[model samples]
Target chain A: MVLQILFIAIALAGVALFSYNLKKVIRNIRIGKAANRTDQPQKRMMTMVKVALGQTKMFFRPIPAFLHLIVYAGFVIINIEVLEIMIDGIFGTHRVFGGLGALYNFLIASFEILALGVWLGCAIFLVRRNIIKLKRFSGVEMTSWPRSDANYILITEILLMTAFLLMNAADAKLQAMGAAHYTAVGSFPVSQFLMNLLPNTEGALIAIERGCWWFHIIGIFGFLNYLPYSKHFHIMFAFPNTYFSNLEPKGEFSNMQSVTNEVKAMLDTSFTPPEPDGSKFGAKDVNDLTWVNLMNAYTCTECGRCTSVCPANITGKLLSPRKIMMDTRDRLEEVGKNIDKTGNGFDDGKSLIDTYISREEIWACTSCNACTQACPINIDPLAIITELRRYAVMEESQAPASINTMLGNIENNGAPWKYSPADRLNWAKES
Target chain B: MSEQLNFEVPTMAELLAKGEEPEILFWVGCAGSYDERAQKTTRDICKILHHVGMKYAVLGTEESCTGDPAKRAGNEFLFQMQAMTNIEVLNAYNIKKIVTGCPHCFNTIKNEYPGLGGTYEVIHHTQLIQDLINDGKLKAEGGESFKGKKITYHDPCYLGRGNGVYEAPRKALEVLDAQLVEMKRCKSNGLCCGAGGAQMFKEPEKGNKDINIERIEEALETQPEVIAASCPFCMTMLRDGVKLKDQDQNVQVLDIAEITARANGL
Candidate 1:
C-alpha cells in the first residue's frame, strides 16, 4: 500500500510539472503576432505524417538516420511496457498483464530486445558526439550548455535502458525461484544474459526488481520535465511545426499588407487607407514575428543540417541558421520571463536584432531555400532572416550602401541599373 | 561571320494598335534589357520565337522591373509599387500567357503578383522551349550539331528550388545532340550563383570565397566545354568565375535559349 501511494504521488507530480512547463511554452509562442496556419487541414495532416511521423527527410544522411530510427522506434515501442508498469505500480500488483501467458511472454521478450537496441543506439550517439566530435555538433553556437544537454539526454537513456533490462533479469530469477507475486510468465530472450549478474536469493532479487521499477518510472518523469528546457523539445514540437508549413513556393515571401495599404494610398490619391494601427513596419523582435515563426524557433533540434547546406555558412559567412533559431528561442524565453515578472506591458530595452542576431549575419543570407529544404522538420529559418531584413530596411531605413544605390536606381530608373525604361527594347535592335 | 538575318519583334502596343493580340507576352527582365551579355540571350530568345512562328509581343518601354530584388532586399513598399505598376500594364493588355528569360522575373510574376490582384500564366523560357521541342516546332537538327561535345546545366535557384521546374530545363537540354553532365550539387540541392536576393547589385559579404566560385568549381569538376545556364544572373556570375579561373577560353558559358537557338538554326 505504501509503495503504491509513493508511485501514485510521483506519477501525478511528474505530469503536473510537465503540464505547467508546456503551458508556459504555448504562452510564449502565443506572444507573437497572429498568423493563420489553420488553412488546408488535410494537407497539413499529410505533411505531419510524412515529415514528422515518417521521418522521410532524415534519410538524407543514411548512417545517422538508421541509428536514429532504431532509437526512435525503441523509445516508442518500449514505452508500451511502461503502460503495464504503470498499472502494476498503481495497484501494487506484479506484472498485471502477465495473465495473458504466451502473448505476455512475446510482448516482454520483444521489449527486452528493443531495450537492448536503445542501449546500443544511445551508446554510439555518445561516442559520435564526444569521441569522434562531429563538426556539425561543435559549431560556435554550440556552447557548453547545449553540448552537455545532449550528453545528459543520451546518458540518461542509457541508464534507463540498463535499469529496464536488469529489472527483467531479476524478475526472471524470482519467477524461477517461485517467489510470491513473481509470476513465471515472461520469456527473457535478451535479459537472460544479465541473470548471472543478479543474485539468486529471493529477497535480493525482489529488491533489485522493485528498485529498477522505481528508477525507470522516475527517470522517465524526470526526462519529460527536462524536455522544454533542452533542444529535445523538438520531440514534442516537430509535429505541429511541420503541420503549419508554408505551402507556397519557397521563393515567395509573405506580402506586407501594411506596406500595401500605404503604397496604394500613395499611388492613388482617391484611395482611402485604413486608420493607422501604429504597428511597426517589420519584425524588430519576437512580438513582431508571426506565431508560426516562434513555434519554428522552438522546434529547432540544433542538428545543423540547415547550416551545413547553407551557401553563406559554407563560404565562411557569420550567418548560421541553427544559431538564428537558438537566438530566437533564447530571446523569446527572455521576453517570456519579463512578462512573468512584470505584467504584459513589460519592456526590456534589448531587441532581437543588434542584441542577439547581427545585421551582418542576417544580410549574408542568399535567400536560397537550402536551409528550408534541408530541415527534417519544415523549419523556415529564411523566413525569419527576411523578416529581420524587412525591419532593417523599411523601419530603420538602414541598408548596405550598394543596396541603397540599387533601390535608388529601381525607384528613379525602371531597372536595378542606371538605365532608362525606353531602353528596354534595345535588346531587340541588337543583332 | 554569317549572313544578316532580319526579323521584326513586335511590342504589345503595336500589336494592340493593329487590332491584334499576341498569343503570349515576353517578359524581358532588367538584365535582359540592359546588361550587354544578357541582351545577347534576349536576342536569341526572340530569334527562337520568330523561328517557331509563334505570335509573341514584348511590353517594351511600358514594362518595368518586377521588384524581385527590391522585395528580397526587404523593401516591401518599393516592391509593391513596382508590382502594382507592372500589374496595371499587364492587365491593360489583358495578357493571359507570359514567358520570361530570367527566373527571378518569372518567379515573381507567377507567384508574388497574384496576391496583388494580378494573375497570369507565367513560365520560364526553358519551359516554353521544352514545350516547343515536345510539339516538334523546335528541333536541334540542321544547325550547330553538338554531337561529340559535353555540356552541363546549372539549375537556377529561383527556377529549381524556388519553384519545382527541374525536369523542364533538363528536357530542353536533352533534346540537344550533346552529352548532359550534372554537378555534384544539382536539381533541388543546387548551389546559389551568389547573385540572388539583391546580391547581384552589391558586393558579397565578407567570406573566405564567393558563392559563384564555389558553384563554378563544382561545375568545372564535370569538365564540360559549355556550362549551360538559364537565368541572366547565373550567366553573369558563372562567366565571371570562368574568367577568374582563366577558363573562359576553354569554358563557354551559354544560356539554354542561346544554345537552343544555335542548335535550331534560329
Candidate 2:
C-alpha cells in the first residue's frame, strides 16, 4: 500500500509539470493572429489521416521510412503496456490485467517484442546519424544543441526500452522463484532470455525490478515534458499541423483582405478612396503571422528533407527551408520566453526578419513549391518565405534594385517592361 | 523553320464591332506580345487555330500584362491595379472561354482572376491542341517532321506541378509519333526553370550552379534530338542552357505550338 501511494504521488507530480509546460506552449502558439482554417473540417480530417496517421509521404524514401515505421509502431503499441503498468502501480496489484489469462500473456509477449524492436530502431538511427554521416543530417543550422538534442532523444529511447526489458526479465525470474507478491501470470517472449543474467535471489530480483520500473516510468515522464522544447515535438504536433495545412492550389497566392478591400474601393467609382489601414502590410514579427504558421513552426521535425529537394538549396543558395522553419520556431521560443519573464506584452528587440532569417534567404526562393511538396508533414515553409518577402518589399522597401525596377515598370507600363501598352502588339507584325 | 504559316488574326474589338463573339479569346501574354522568340509561338498558335477552323480573337492593343511578375515579386499593390484593369476589359467583352500560349498567363487568368471577379474558362494552348487532335479536327499525318525522333518534353513548373496538367502536354507530344523520352525528373517532381516567382527579372543569388543549367543537364542526359516545352519562360531558360553548352545547332529547343504547327504543315 505504501509503495502504491508513493508511485501515485510521483506520477501526479510529473503529470502536473508536463501539463504546465504544455499549456505554456499552447499559449505561445495562440499568441499569433487568428486566421480561418475551420472552413473545411472534412478535408482537413482526410489530410490528417493520409499524411499523419497513414505515414503516406514518408514512403518517398524507403529505408528510413521502414525504420521510422518500426519506431512509430513500437511507440504506439508499447503504450498499451504502459497503461497496465500505471494501473498496477496505482492499485497495488501484481500485473493488474493478469486475470485475462491467455489474452494477458499474448499482450505482454507482443509488448516485449515491440520493446526489442524499439531498441533496435533507436540503435540504428544513432548509427545513421553518427557513423554513416548522411548529408541531410549535417548543415549549418544543425550544429550544437540541435545536433545533441537528436542524439539525446535516440539514446534516451534506447535506455528506456532496455529498462523495460530489464524490469520484465527481473519480474519473470522472481515469479519463477515463487517469491512473495510475485506473479507468474505474464509471458516474456523477448525478455525471457535475460532471466538467466538476473541473480537468483529475492533481494536482488526485487531491487533490479524496482529500479528498472522507476527508471522506465520516470524517463517517460521526462521525455513527455522535454518534447515542447525539442524538435521531436513532431510526434505530437504533426497530425494537427498537417490537418490544418493549406489545401489551395500550390501556385495561387492568398490575396490580402486589406489589399482586396482597397482594390474594391478603387473599382467603385462613386465611393471616395479611404485612408490606408495602419496595420503593416505583411509579417514584421511573430505576432503578424497566423496561428497555423506558428503551429507549422512547432511541428518541424528538423529532418532537412525539404531542404534536400529544394532547387535553391540544392544549387547552393543561402535559402534552406529547414533553416527557415527552425528560425521561426526559435524566434517563437524567444518571444514566448520574453512574455514569460516579463508580463503579457513584452517587447523583444529582435524580430524574425533581419535578426534570425536574412533577406538574402527570403529572396533566394523561387517559390517553386518543391519544399512544400517534399515536406513529409505538409509544413509550408514557402508560405512563411512569401510573407517575409512581402514584408521586405512592402514594409521595408528593401527589395533588390532589379526587383524595384520591375515593380516600377509594372506601375508605369501595365507590364514588367519599359515598353508602353501601345507597343505590346509591335512583335505581332510580320517577323 | 521550313514550315509555311498562314493565318488572318482578328482583334476582339473588330469581332465585337461585327456583332460576333468568338469561341475563345487568345490571351497573348506579355512575352507573346513583345518578345521576338515568343512571338513565333503566338503565330504558330494562330496558325493551328486557323487549321482547326476554331474562331479565336486576340485582345490586341487592349490586352496588358496579367501582372504575374509583379505579384510574384511581392508587389501586391501593382498586381491588384493591373489585375483590376484587365478584369474590367475582359468583363466588358463578356469573354466566356480563354486560351493562352503562356503558362503564367493561363495560371493568373484561371486561378487569380476569379478572386478579382473575372472568371472564365482558361485553357493552355497545349491542352487546346490536344483536344483538337483528339476531336479529329487536326491530324499529325505523313508530314510529321518529328516522327521516330527522340523527343523529350520538359514539364514546366507552372503547368505540371503548380496546376497538375502534366498529361495534356505528354498527350500532345504523343501526336508527333516520336519516341517520347523523359528526363529523370518529370511531372510532379519537375525542377523549376529558375524563372518563376519573378526570378526572371533579376539575377540568381550566389550559387554553385544555375538551376536552369542543372535542369538542362538532366534533359541532356536523355540525349534527345529535340527538347520540348510549353512555356515561354521555360523556352528561354532551356534555350540559354542549351546555348551555354554550345549545343544549339545540334539540339533544338522548341515550344509545343511550334512543333504542332509544323507537324500539321501549317
Please give, for residues A1-431, the per-residue lDDT of candidate 1 as tens digits.
99899999999999999999999999999988988889999999999999999999999889889888888888988888999999999998888888999999999998988888889999999999999998889777899998998999999999999999999999898888899887688999999999999888888998999899899999999999999999999988999999998888998888888888999999899999998778787889998889999999999989999998889889988999999999999999999988888965237789999999999998898898999999999999998999999999999999999999999999999799999887888877765
Number of backbone collisions per candidate, in order?
Answer: 0, 1
Q: Please, what is the whole-model Cα lDDT of each candidate in the order they appear?
A: 0.91, 0.87
Fnat for each model: 0.79, 0.60
Give the CAPRI rating of model 2. medium
Which pairs of residues have clashing backbones in candidate 2? Answer: B4-B266
Q: Write the per-residue lDDT of candidate 2 for residues A160-200, one digit (tens) a residue.
A: 99999999999999999988888688899999999999898
Model 2 lDDT, residue A413, Cα: 79
Model 2: CA > 4 A from native: A272-277, A344-346, B1-5
